[model samples]
Target: MLNRCIATDAGSFATQYWGRQPLLSPSGSLPRDFSDLLSGPMVDELIAERGVRAPFIRMASHGDLLARDCYLGPAGFGAEMPDQVDSAKVLAQFAAGATIVLQGLHRLWPPLIDFVREMVADIGHPAQANAYITPPTSRGFDPHYDVHDVFVLQVQGEKRWLVHEPVHQDPLTTQPWTDHRAAITERVREDAAIDRVLAPGDSLYLPRGWIHSAEALDNTSIHLTIGVAPLTVLDVVHAVVDTLATVGEFRTSLPMGIDPTDRGSMAAIATKVMAEVTDTVQHRATDISEGSATRLSQRHAQRTRPVAVRPLESLAAAEHAGFHPVEWRRGLVAHVDHHADRVVLRLPDRTITFPALCSPALDALHHGLVADATSLPGLDQDDAAVLIRRLLREAVVIPAKQPEHPTRTSRG
Candidate 1:
């Protein structure tokens, strides 16, 4: 997925352009156009039939965002949802040159959902998709930067993009483009780094903090922006600090009678605390490292979701457990923690434990190698069937398919 958008391989993209610079792939350079992901008819269907609500849809005209009241109203009668998108209002706004923004399409649109999931796996970061539909000769936003890196996919028509260097490089989520408004305005007057019209099948990769803006050219333009939020060094530091909460010394109050406003007193306290923290970190290095790793992994797991599972189908599979092939759930995050007498399967939302004898089988499953009960390592036929059933019930694996012939089970 990352290769589809860039001219180079994934390794080159990471080292050369991932968060360092922008890369523009003109039309025909990409594998294909993005109409399968989104289109003008699809946009109309989302507005008129999907019952989309506020925050998911937004409108902007001439660099100013239109209020929700201008485009949202009641769903009428049975639904009665006051925030449902009013298609009539949207038409009115769009006809007047407002650009329509479909935010979080990865959660709302099926094609984008799958596309973004693959993208996340490819880029090793949390990702989301949003589509922008702008009328001919209209601009939706002023030149600005996003805190997260973005890959722009031109789905339809053409859009002239103007890209400039950042005023403040690699801004965090809390630091928005608005914080550097004066510098950004001043910087855009200079020669742009890139000024090109992106047509269908074109793509542009912009690292976080690169200033850019787009204006539709001659016709309505639709493009999908895939935003990638990469974890930073500060995130690791935060996890390490969280580990410090387990240390009693870190929980102690500040020195008594220290003047809060005195630089000398504050410096003394800071020095003492820093020394204590460094000593603790050195002595409890293993424990702190393990705790920090767990915290970071759990946080990443929470930010992503596994592929959707069908409840009724899963229940049926569980109740009728057989020697059918079972595959690991897509995007499922699992950790195998071994104990003296048991093995724990740690997931993002919960944990499951099995007897120590099941360790080999669990490890096989964790690595996505378990095919069926009989194929499970170490465990006997009956125990393997039980484990498979339990995993199916727990939504850890889904039924891939049934075997052509029923294989007779043998008692251990």
Candidate 2:
């Protein structure tokens, strides 16, 4: 339950935030204890139960004169593994001095998934979100900046950060190592704008393209880095070209004259076609932003099949009639099918359909309004028997009365 303090001084804060000059956030603590949120017991459980992968982490070299001490893999290995390390030892190393931890956040336990969801919301993007935790000893990453913006939250313990101002103002992309290494070199020579320490509950916001490094300062330091997905002009252009390729006009060859020396004319035709492609791509961004928008665009676990329904025990008189209940559980999306003759419903992630009339029964059971078909309204013996059979087949409804207890219990 990390508490976040958004910048209150909008005027001054906005002026200094993520601009050419570096800035530090006003120190604040999180609302909840991180230990309680991610207890040690839970950490062990995650490692034991969940098939967690540990990707190779990287570190920056001080100079060519020194040898690189590779860990887990090669200098730039990003392999995945399933193993738990000493949390205290990693924290101590960060406290000693280490920068960056690759694939650190993706290894988080399930308890932290909610926190990751909220952080993605704060970034104002619907992209899939993940986090990396850097203990004191381990540098999860190298002394490099990320291509996308990041929201760093100190969940527990303490960490120090050194932020370097952008050398190339408003770069097309951050983490210039992939494209603009020359620009990164120039910026590093210019000098860092801010250096500060962050303790538990403190958060630091770094816009994409800014250079920065961090190290743990406490015995156990845990932090969450929320990454923002970047949408580039090239991406838009590519998308537009792909869409236009369906048109015959785009596939047709340009009007090339028979004269072999008319190369200049061919160049002009190519330029005009490229311009059209670029324009279409620019407009297509709006469609990509709206039509495909998801709450959390990141990949998630595959949805499980709906629960099976059980027969109603109260409808003993009507052997032919059965009832089954299907619930639209919270945090899940589903659809209902209500026809004049039959009732059916479908889940967003599954194709399973249930009787539409069963919707009310599911609601009643989910809300604890009825113990079983005995408490349902207008559900006669025959209807109850049919509903029970359907629910049990779909796994959407369960027995209200367990064998251990002869009497009916509250429906859940």
Best by TM-score: 1
- lDDT, candidate 2, 44-84, per-residue tens: 45433443334423323221111122222121235333233
lDDT of each: 0.88, 0.48
Residue 263 displacement in candidate 1 (angstroms):
1.5
Candidate 2 local Cα displacement, residue 294, angstroms? 11
For residues 1-412, write the lDDT of model 1, one tens digit per residue: 7766776788888888888999998766335768999999999999999999989999999889999999999988999989999999999999999999999999999999988888888887899999999999999999999999999999999999999998998899999999999999999999999999998888999999999999999999999999999899999999999999998878988768879999998988899888988999999999999999999998878887777777888777777665666767778888999999999999988989999999988877667663677778898878888988899889998876444433322110
Q: Any runs in candidate 2 off by more than 4 Å, and if so which?
A: 1-5, 8-24, 27-51, 56-108, 121-142, 168-178, 218-220, 232-238, 254-267, 274-412
- The residue pairs in collision within model 1 are none
